[model samples]
Target: MLDLAWRPRAHLDRESIAIHLGLERKAPQAALDAMRRIDDAIERVRTFPDSGGRVRLDALRRTEYRTVLANPYTVYYRFDEKTLTVYRILHQCQNIDTYALVDLPR
Candidate 1:
């Protein structure tokens, strides 16, 4: 069987989710639903990053050390032969550049 890995960025992504959940004015059900979608999306990538290089999640794209879904947030990572190293997570709304996320350790 193939191995699965998550870049450290996934941790930050989870933290970001926590913050979103903490928002006081949002509907609980809708927040939970979105969280579930985000969680499911990441897990889906773990199970199948590509079907021979075609993405399991068609909505994401690879950047230098990061992967961006349709805005809102991004996932940074590095892929080795058998493992993926997550670097950091950020909200696209931050108005920052890639270097801002470089502070994350491998």
Candidate 2:
């Protein structure tokens, strides 16, 4: 089993989602669901990113930050060996870097 732990970056994701919720009614369900799928995807990705099963972020330099989109929303997750961290959750148009936090050994 994967040992998952979310860092401060995850909170940024929550805040991003909140912003969307405030702007519209019915909440960001599609985004929320995408995040959930991402959580599940992390396990497999943790095992392998080149599995052709998940979308990998190629613009972030040498980072593991990647997102899976559900319509206008994007679910962001980070994988660290045994831990698959559910970091950021946001819409496709959201400024992804604004929520970006580099990883350091904890």
Query: lDDT of each model, Cα atoms only?
Result: 0.51, 0.57
lDDT of 1 by residue, 1-106 (tens): 2254554556766666756765754666755765665555455545554412322332333443435352355555445456655455556565445454454465
TM-score of each: 0.54, 0.52
| Model 2 global lDDT (CA atoms, 0 to 1) | 0.57
Q: Write the per-residue lDDT of candidate 2 for residues 22-68, one digit (tens) a residue.
A: 44545677556655665555556556643422434456646656665
lDDT of 1 at 46: 52
**After TM-score superposition, what is the CA distance of residue 44 in candidate 1 from its true location, in Å?**
2.8
Q: Identify the leading candidate in terms of lDDT.
A: 2
lDDT of 2 at 37: 60
Which stretches of model 2 miss by more than 4 angstroms?
15-59, 102-106
